[model samples]
Target: MSATYDVYIKKLTTQELGYRKGRLMTGGYFYISKSAVGSFFKELDKYVLNDFLRLDFNDPLEPGNIIQASYVYHNDKYAKENGTRNEYRIYHNRAIAKHQLHFQPYEIVVFIKDGDDNYRIEHYTRNDKAYRILENIIEDSKIRGQHALLQLSEYNTLLNV
Candidate 1:
């Protein structure tokens, strides 16, 4: 299994004293490899926006910049959004399974803005305590929404996976 990392952006808030504070915000999570991270940054530099600079994992990121990145492998195989509709129709040989055979990341290009006004992209691997804290924050925020909480069984399954 590939390593999963929790990605987030620090939202910056300006105070009356001309200082800025950063608040942790969810930018979604993904299961990706370290090499993929470098490739992603390369693409981000080549394409995306003209003003946006390429991320340097060795150094710090720039503030007030936007990162348009997505979970690499997550996609609806039969959807019309991309070219998958035709590909699935032509190659599908069996009934679609209810459960996914592999992990499907939350497919979305998480747009992260340096809210702290500091040039840094915060990321935590699965083993970090900060990862757990951010996960709790995400769960709490979701609970506050209209959706019902995940059942204990489902939560357990997620943890095991």
Candidate 2:
């Protein structure tokens, strides 16, 4: 409404989209980009750094029903010790299995932070009008190869962060 806003737009990769093994959705996780993760979230009080916390997210597609996702964190510190740097990733959920969220590879996944642990998630393909609008709004410079954390204002805002 005003000028600046907090938003995360990710152009999904094939691995990020997961595959359908004869109708079974397998091997996909909603990974939170560190570039986009600023102060959008409050203090990490809901879940521990290295723990599985059940997250019941609101899905507009399924009215009166919430999709579930396990919030998981793999700290960067572990990367130094031979683990991994996937600090913010949400996996092992029922959203895909239950068809609560529709998505595909190369489509963009949007995260508009309404509050801590609360966001309006949207998926858009390249052919979508909304995606075209976003294409004009999200500048080429802001994106890092495939994905980048982005923010837009009321005027289809586009600028380098």
TM-score leader: 2
The window of 10 residues in a row where model 2 has the poorest summed lDDT is 39-48
RMSD of each: 19.6, 5.7
- lDDT minimum window of 10 residues, candidate 1: 85-94
Q: Model 1, range 40-100, lDDT digits (tens) per residue?
A: 2222232222222222221224444433323232223333234331110001011211122
Q: Over the stretch 1-161, how does candidate 2's per-residue lDDT look in tens digits?
A: 22234676667655655756534256677766544443342223323346455655568578666676766666645434555545666673556434424566667766666555666667788887677655554555354545545454642444222
Q: Kindly report which residue stretches of model 1 are placed more than 4 angstroms away from their true locations once superposed.
A: 1-112, 115-119, 143-161
lDDT of 2: 0.57
Best by lDDT: 2
- TM-score, one value per model: 0.23, 0.66
